[model samples]
Structures are given as structure tokens and as C-alpha cells.
Target: MKLRKPVIWFGIAMIMVMVVTGVVMFMEKVNVFATGTALSDNGWKAHFSEPLAKEAITNGYVYVTDRDGEKVGAELVLTDKGRTLQVEGLQPGNYTLRMEQKAVNSQFKSLKKKKVDFIVYDSIESISSAADLKLYFERAKDMQSVSVSEDMAGSSEKATMESAKAESSDAVGGGDHSSTNIQVEGVDESDMVKTDGDYVYSVFGGTSVKVIDIRNPKKMKVAAEIKPNDDYYPTQLFLHDDLLIVLGDKMVRYPKRSASQAEIMPMNSLTTIRLYNIEKPEKPVLIREIGVEGYLKSARKTDGMLYLVTNVHPYLWAMEEIEGDALRPRIFDSNEKEKEFMDFKDISILPGAIDPSYSVIAAIDLTSPKTSQLETKGFLGSSDQMYMTKDHLYLTALKYETSTNSRGAEIMIWNPGRADTEIFKFKLDGTNVEFHRSAELGGTILNQFSMDEYKGNFRVVMTEGNMWDERNPSKNHLYILNENMELTGSVKGLAKGERIYSARFMGDKAYMVTFRETDPLFVIDVADPVNPTVLGELKIPGFSNYLHPLDENHLIGFGYETSAQKNPSGGEPLILTKGMKISLFDVTDFHNPEEKFTEIIGGRGTYSPLQYDHKALLQHKKKNLFGFPVSIYEEGEKEFEVDFTGAGALVYEITPDRGIVLKGDLVQKKASGQQYEEWETQVQRLVYSGESLFTLSMDEVKSYSLDSFKEISTLKMK
Candidate 1:
């Protein structure tokens, strides 16, 4: 057929385009996956649906490029059975990652390549203005709507002066004076027991606060029982002059959409505070009550002001768009007619935090009337650990994203890689809370005991390591941050193979215990905040889960006794914890710390509340008395079978010179083989008033003579 030159050329071009498009579509069959949009300065990671051959990945299979499509020189490695890839040496900026899958499954012969764009941040960026925060929230709301699979569900403060006065009387008085074994001397930690010469205020059964008359220790009686709403569970209590404050959490459940349909998670925790007028012990009156949306993270009382912290994870998934007003946390005051939502102006967000969670800090005046106001500051993050000094409140939140392929292909994803902790500091002055500064640090903080402020510098101890990386063994770190939350000095690279079990900072000296197969008690000198030094180390047979300072040079270690077994496959030794272990560490000589005295109790499964919660430890240093709850687990004939050897309080006479001497065991009598009964008694706390020592359980309170450790009286709580 005869045709014009232009028409013939157009027909040829169309045929060429169709052929190229078909080839491109076939080559894109293998999906290259990127876990998240954000990358850390450390590096970026990518994943693939199927494993890749090592040779294929090495020969430029995965690489990152800048905006101009120019290849960036970097090191790429395959992990997780060659299913995951990581790229390092990239700076903080936007970059496009190119991942090429050269080999497909045996069933398919074609392979494809994909590219993804991501941003690597140098550090957490705080919102500069309200407008910026609102925009970030909008983006977060939209991103959250795209449901991530359940297998990928990896979502990761201050001292007050009322404490200053309380510190002066921390020592055990001669006749009947005793106080809570607090982390810091003058800093009063909220506990179940608060004594004022004649009466004892305690939290009982998590359902009510009990006030007992201790004037007659031989015949202790319940003076008053203060109960809150049905949904509230009282956990801790604080007392100030004529008032008693109860701290707890209230869980609210909602009706399901349909009776046949399963209900959502029932418990929505809200931080609740209840103040009672205890002037008349027989008739305690509820003076004030407040419920704020969020689970209580931690709270402290200082200088007559109560600093309360709560972390709220809002139900933003149910809504299409992020509601700015709904984000503000709600608070209820007894004086108010109804619960009121906090003003948006009162809420503040730090830069670099793009998440929608709320970290609310509220300061309440203890002396204020029922109509008193509360000062609150809210940030957009979730605080896991709180460390508060006399003048400042520190909120620490660990930020991390789930990398499913960090480990091999398993249905369940484990939290691997180390987390970056975002620390938000707030200055405290009476009833006012002013945001001071914010900074980011590496590793995860254990608890409040993991942090301390000395000489205007904050000292924090954290364990650093990746669960997936065997080369990066867990190590403890002592980071010294100034008042501005900037790192000034650090004592890193400590206990390479072990993680920090417990840490305590006492003035110029710090004591830390790390464990793997055994315990290594390290004594670090912070006399120079800029050049902190580890003076001595004491290796013991067990790990100390908590460190309590006895005096200037003495420390009490509460933990478990563990034995090491050689791995049959010739890998690292496996540590097998056996029983409750308490060690007395003498650091009188900084060059040589010694575990002078050790106490091992029960058998393979013995458990003690003291090993987990510091509040469970009761000690009267001056009286030379220490005690904690013990649930003896005696061994049986079979490996799995265990015999419960009655639970009770184990008391000891602890002294610098005499060491730990068992005074007696106040055993709670119960029927055999009965795991729990109507009046099941598991001793949890111990306190002393006058010449009597009191042991507290969930169902009853028993008193004993301090001098002879003889049973005196019993008060039952039902």
C-alpha cells in the first residue's frame, strides 16, 4: 500500500511505545517494600517479599540516590535470611532508595526493581508554631487511617518542697517513727503507708484507702475507710497536714455497637485524684476529686504542689480527620458541675514529635480550696519513665518504629533495635509548671531510679543494645545532661555483655548493677559531672534488680540468684535464675566494692515483690531493720510441679557491721494446695510505728512487736 512519509513514521513510533510499556510492566512484578517513610540518621532499612541471593544483593542490588537521581555511595548489607536490606552512611536529608530484586521465586522467572522516597531526620523536630503542629496532626491522621497489619504493631518528672520538709524526718526515730524507703531522702515518694504519729493512711485492696489508729499499736483498728467510684482503683496515697490525697486510675468501658458483635478493649484508663479531709479520722470527708483522661504515668508532690503526669492515647482512628479540640485532655473537678475539657491553648507540643499521643503534666496546689485551678502542660508523645528532682520534672519517652524483618520471617515480630529517648524537662516552682527544655538520648531508661539530678546536672543510666544484633551486646550508660538537657559528660561502654538491672545515684557516688550470667555491681564516681568515672566493680552470683542506699558507703541489692549453664550448641551461656537474692554491698573502699553479706531465700521459683517494685521494700535504717514480701517456691519431685511454701513477710536485721541476720518470718497460715482462697494472704508491705511492726497483705494487716518480733494484733480488710 502506498502511504505518505509522515503517516508511516507515526505508525512505527506507536508500535515501539507499546512494546516498551509491556516489557516494563512485566519487569515490575517483584514488589520492593519499604517499612516506613521516616529514616533515622543511623540509616535506612528495606525489605523484600522473597529472599535474594547474596551475590545479587552485593552487585548493586540495593542503593540510595539523591534528588537528581545520582547514586549515593553507601554500604548495603542483607539481613534476616537475605530478605531484609540496610543502607548506612546516608546523611540527614531526603533520599530515594532503589532496590532491585534480580531473582524471583522458582515459579516465576521475571524479577522487578522498585524505588521509594524517605526522609532521614538528624533528630526529633519540634513543632515551631501552632500552625505547623496542626498540619503535622492532619498528616498523621491521614496516615493512621491506612491500617497496618497486627503483625507490624510496634508502636513505641519533678521534685516538690513538701518533699524538702519530709526529708528532714526520713531517719528512723527512736521509739515509733518510720517512713517509706524512698529513692531520695527528702523526696517523699507516694506509698500505701503514710504515718503521722497517731494514725496510718494506707491503700488497701486497690479498692479503698484505709486509715488506721496506730497510737495503740497492740490494738490497731481501722479508723476510716474512704472508697471512690466503682470504676476507680486506688494505687497510692499521700498525706499533707489535715488532708489526705489518694492517687489512682479509673477505667471506663462503653457499650458495644451490637450485642452480637464483640466489644472493644474494655479498659480506658483515666488518671484520678481524690482529696479527703482527715481532720476527723472517724469520719473522713471527700474534699475534692478530679479525673483526667489518660493513664497516670507518674506523680510527685513537692513544695505543697502535686505534680501529676499522665499519658493518653486518643481514639483518633475512629474519626476521619484529627479533631484539635478533642485532642485536648479532659479534667473533672469536684467543685465543677461537670467534667470540662482542657483548653487548646494550654496544650503544647515539642518540635520533632509528630505522633498524636499526649503527655500531660498537671500541677495542683495542695492548700487550695475546692475551687482551686490546675496548671497543665501537654506534649505530643508517650512518656514511659519519669524522673523528678526537687526543682525539675523530667518526662522520658522512647520513640521507635517496628522493623518486622529485623529477625527472620516469623509470624510474631519482636521489638528489636535500640530506641531513642525523648526527654522533656519542666521547671517546678510551687504550683506552677514551666517547660524548660527538651533533648534526645540513646537507649531505654529503666524507671525513675534510672535518673537523678546532682549539682544542676541530670544523670541518667540506660541500657543500650539491639535485640537482633549479637555483636552489639547490651551495655549500661551513665549520661550526664545539664539543666538544659544537653549531654555534658558520659560514662559509656560499661558491662559489655550485660544489661543494667538497677541503678541508684547517691550524691557524688552512683551504684549500678548489670546482669547476664552473674551480677556486676559497679560503683561510679560522678564527683566530676563532666568526667564521670567507674571506680570499682564487684561481681556476684546474682543480679540486683533494685539498689537501695544504706549509708554513704553501704548499698542493699534486691534481686535474684542465677546459675549459668553452658549452651549445648557452644553459644553464649544461658543464665537460669533460681531464687530471691539480697546482697549487702560495701563500697567503703571505692577501689574495691565488696558484697560482704548475701542472703538467698527459697528455691528455683521463689519470688519476692521487692525484686520488681521498690515500694515493696520496707526498711528502717536507724532501727537496722529491713523486710519484704516472700513467696517461697520449694522444689518438687517433677520438673514442672512446685510446692507453695506459704507466703509471708521476711524480716531481717541489716547493719553495716553485722550484715543481714534473719530476725523471723511472719508466715501467713493457709490450707495446702490452695492457690488462692477467700482470705488469701500474700504479704506485700511492712511499716513500723512505735514499738510495733506492721505487715500488709491484700486481705489483712498484722502487727508484731518490734523488739521480739512476736505477734501483737491483726486487722482484717474485706
Candidate 2:
């Protein structure tokens, strides 16, 4: 009997041990690895076997850390009824996801701490098929929804203002005359006016392109007028050899509807290029017409080939109904019978770009215009600015990042009050443009001049943060990248609290101007692509909007002069613009640059188109002359008011020995009591052929002798 009692007690002890083991095993199964951990677009997700404690899914208990154990900036959300943890804003890097004890259900108290080591990819993979493309857009659409509401409130007004600014800003040349003020010596950019030494072609009255014979400036006459159909409006011109190319916008209307349907469909816009045989200037012959679907962004001609870039934003939200090519950009060539949509194989995704727009690039072989040798490719992204050389083309797109607050809620910010620029490079070979690679910079580019390619190295200048916001004052930076678009070296955090106003890259040097209360011209040595350093800085009381190289040792700064004024509201002193300022800088000693001479025009409201458009300035290098059109305004009796004095083209002889000497002024006589500029008489461009200079306005073309500054003759067009 005693032996039986001992055996029964042993069996009971064994049974209790078995029960405990089973319970522990079941608890282990209800952990975070129930499904699996996976990466997502800009984030990652962890699946749990059982629901987690709402309070435990926080920055304290559940967080992401770098390899060095530093907490990473991310947003955590409890999704799928608290069974899933979503962490977002985690860039591509090695990370360790830590889930402390008690992060899961409290019932499983024996749970130990969990740590997951993984890598976050860039998620910038290319689309391989139509399904992949659709999925990519679907995800993009969902992501954009979070911030669309906030963006919509101000988008329309902002877009209108930008459109107006773009329309107002824009500019040609050649003899012993001025060529279009181009960035590259050999590469030519399209402008509103173009000259071939003997004749000047210009877009007049925004309606037609007029060919003016400049062989005899005093007797200059309109040789011919090339007018397109009413559907097209000419904007810019390009002259190569005996071929004249006219670029404009054409309105495409929908098919006519029945009488019962009173509503009309919206019209679409296209960029049209018309090539003319100008062998006989008296009667130009239109040889070919090419139409690309979008608004013209930029165009360049080099190595006997013409390249055109346009941005197209399709109705992607209607992709479900409009299938295939209907959602793609199309191109029409006069050589072909019908227009065709770009093939899917030719459309590739832009790395790091999220915009659902297409940047279409078309290349035309001017060497054989009649043969119709044209190549067009579309990239799924949006381009704000374009810079090109003889061998490569570069495009820039701005990208914004979504951030989280202290509470881990996603908030719409301007990429934390700043934007990043993504640069894409394309190889150019005759009429072929191939995608090479891409890279990113830390700020937004001011304009096309902000980028340059030199000696197989690409140099860029950018401005970060908002200049108007004191809390986040802007800072400038210079980045150098290799041919593959990889960062080779950088000069960062330059000109703190100021923004870049103008930038220019010379052979082995780069000049940048940043402005706030004063202007600082930074001269940087870029001879060593890996270690660029600032050689010198010149601080003055004004800013330069454009920088032109007078020679290897001198630079011309064109901008506005300013004065500090006592603020009526009593904060920071108000900076009041005084007048147009032109500065001649001598960089003979790289380490000691000097503003050799300065010239200031009218005061207060004085303005000139040359401030915004580089092509507006005519550079007669041989004669040491620089000239631009200006509208003069001086401060009046009332505060913040100015009276217009006159409008004219001013020519100055700028030299190191003799500063800036005003050679002549062609001011149009204003009517009695005139207080504003008259558009008809406002000079728009200045060009010189042989010894005669020509001034073009909306109403007439006038010629003046370079020797005496006397008006020779005028040809009225209006």
C-alpha cells in the first residue's frame, strides 16, 4: 500500500510539469512573428499572432533604432485591429526593430524582448509591366490623398501666380553682333529672338514670326511674315544654317458634339515645332511640323540635333476607364500620316520621383529634316528645370518627405520646411538620348544656371529652407557629382541665413551670390572635384540676380541695390530696394575679389527684364559693351509710391580700366503726365549687326549707329 501511494504522487507531479510546458509553448506562438515582417514603400510592417496593447504600441515600448542604437525618426501606427505595427519614414539603411517586454498582450507575461535586424531598400525599382505600373500609380494616389486636402486650398492660386510669372519672364543674335547669352559656348538655346548676322527673326505680336533684313540697318524691312494657323501661337525661334524652326503652342479641340449636348469639352494644349526653308527670305517655305503633347519646358540645339522637352500631366485617376496608350503621351510628325502614342517599353520610371507626370524628350536631326529622323522618349516624372551640354542632358525634380509629430501622427510639412532636388542625367548622342543615372541634392535649384557640367564633373548650387521665415532661414550649398551622378564631394552650409540669388560656374571656379540684408559673392575653387573650397567672399549692400563673366578674371553682377530702413512695426529693419545696380567684379586674385565699379539706375520701383531673363542682356564683347532694356521709376512724395520717368535701352561700355561708361540711351518720349510704361514702345530686345544696333519693340524696329548713338531709321510693324 505504501509503494502505490508513492507512485501515484510521482505521476501527479509529472502531469503538472507537462501542463506547464504546453502552456509556455502556446504563449510563444502568440508572438509578433505569427505572420512575418515585411518591407513597404517608405516603411515596414510587423504582424502579430495576437492583438497588442494599444498603449504599448508607442515610441517607448516599440521603436526603431540604427545599427549604433540611436532612435530613428519614424511614425508607428496600430493597424489591422492592433495586430499589425506600421513604421514609416524609414529611409534606406540598416535598422533594428525593438519590441520590449510587455509590448504584446498582458496575458502573456512571460514574453521576452524581441529584436529584428533588417535592411530597408530604397524602393525606387523600375516598373516591368503594365500591372506593375498601375500598382505603382495606385500606391502613389493613396499616398497623395493624405496631403491633397491641405494642398488643394492654395494650389490653384499658387499655380496661377507661377504661370503668370513664367509668362512674364523669357528672350537672341550674330555678326560682329551679340549671340543669345548662352550658358555653354557651343550649345544654343532657343529664344524669342534669333539673328544670323544678315537677318533677324523674331516672334512679333505673339502671332507670327517676322523675318527682318538687317543687311542695311537704316533701311531694315520685314522681308516676310510666316504665320501659322489660328490654332497655333508662336513663342520662340531657332535658326540653324538655312533652316528656321518656330516653336509655339497649339490648341487641340475635341470633336464637335450634337446640338442636344450643350456642354463643350475642354481643349488640350500641345507644343508644336514648324521647320521652314529660309533659303529665300522673301517667301519662307514650311517644310515640316512636329507636335508633342505637353507644354514646352525647354529646348536646346547642339551637334546638328535639336532637343525639346515637355511636361505632360495625364488624367491618371481615370486610368480604370482610359486604358493603355490613352493615358500615355503622344507625338505627331508631318512625315508620318498619323500621331502615335509612346510605347510602354520606351517609358521608364524616374528614380526617387513620385509624381504621376511624364517628361517627354524629342530629338530631331536637323541635318536631315526631310528624312524625319526623330526619336522621342518619355520618363514618368515631372521636371522643373533642364541643363544640357553637348554630350549630356540633365533635369531636376523637387521631392518632399512626409514627417511625423511627437505623437507619431503623419503631418504634411514642406519636407520639414525644405525640399530636395533629384537630378537625372541622360546621355546624348546625335539624335539618341539614353537614361544614364540619377542622384539627389539637399535643396531646390534657383534656375538653370544653378547647374553646370565641367570636365566630367557636375556642379550644382542649391538653397534650403524659406528665406522669409526667420526661424528657418535659408542656407546655400554646392555639390559636385561624378559622371555617374554620384556625390564626389560637397561644400555645405554656406551663407547661413541667406538664399542663393545667382550662381555661375567658370572653367575651374564657381561664383555664388547669396542675399539677405546684404549680398555675399562667394568665389570657390573647383579645380579639385573632390574638395572644393571657398577662395574668397565679397559682402556688399545689394544682390545680383545674374552673373556674367567679362573675362577669366572679371565678372559682371546685374541686380538691385538696397538700403536699410527703420521698420514701422519695430522688428528687423526693413530692406528697401533703391534702384538697378550693375557691379563689375575683378577676381584677378582669387583670394581677394573686389567690386571694381558699381552703377545704380532709377530708385524704388525701377525694374528691368534683364533681372530675371539672362537672354535679355546683350553682350557685345568686342566693343566692351553691355546693354539691356529698362523701365525707370523714382520714389515720389508718398511713401511706397514711385513715378515712372521713362523706358528705354541703355548701353554701357564696361572695362577694367574705365569702369562702366554710359555710351547711349534710347528713351522713348512719354506723353504728358504719363505715369506708367507704354507696352507698345517698351523695347524688348537689343541686337547688333555689323556697326548698326537694332532695338525691337512691339510696335516698331529701330536702328542706331554704334559710333554716334543716333537713330538711323524705324520700321513700323503695328
Using TM-score as the measure, which candidate wins? 2
Tens digit of per-residue lDDT, candidate 1, span 1-718: 8999999999999999998777765543443444333334335665554566677655775668887889988777877566566777777777887755454433343333356666666554544454655665665554442323232223321111011111222434344566665655555678877777688787767878888887886777888887765878999888887888889988864223345424542456778888888889878888788877798877777767788889887765444445455456777777774647766566765534445678888878887746678777677666777877778888886643322222322111223344456677888887677777776665777677787787788888877664325644566689998877768899988988567778777788887877777788888888887899999998878788777667777877777788888889998877777778878888899989999999988777787767766767666766688888888876679854667766788889888899999996886655765653233467767878777788877777788988898898888767
lDDT of 1: 0.69
In the range 513-555, model 2's lDDT, one tens digit per residue, is: 8887998999999889999999999999999888877777888
Over 4 Å off, model 2: 1-138, 146-175, 254-265, 316-322, 402-416
Q: How large an RMSD does model 2 have? A: 11.5
Model 1 residue 495 CA deviation in Å: 1.7
TM-score of each: 0.77, 0.79
Lowest summed-lDDT stretch of 10 residues in model 1?
157-166
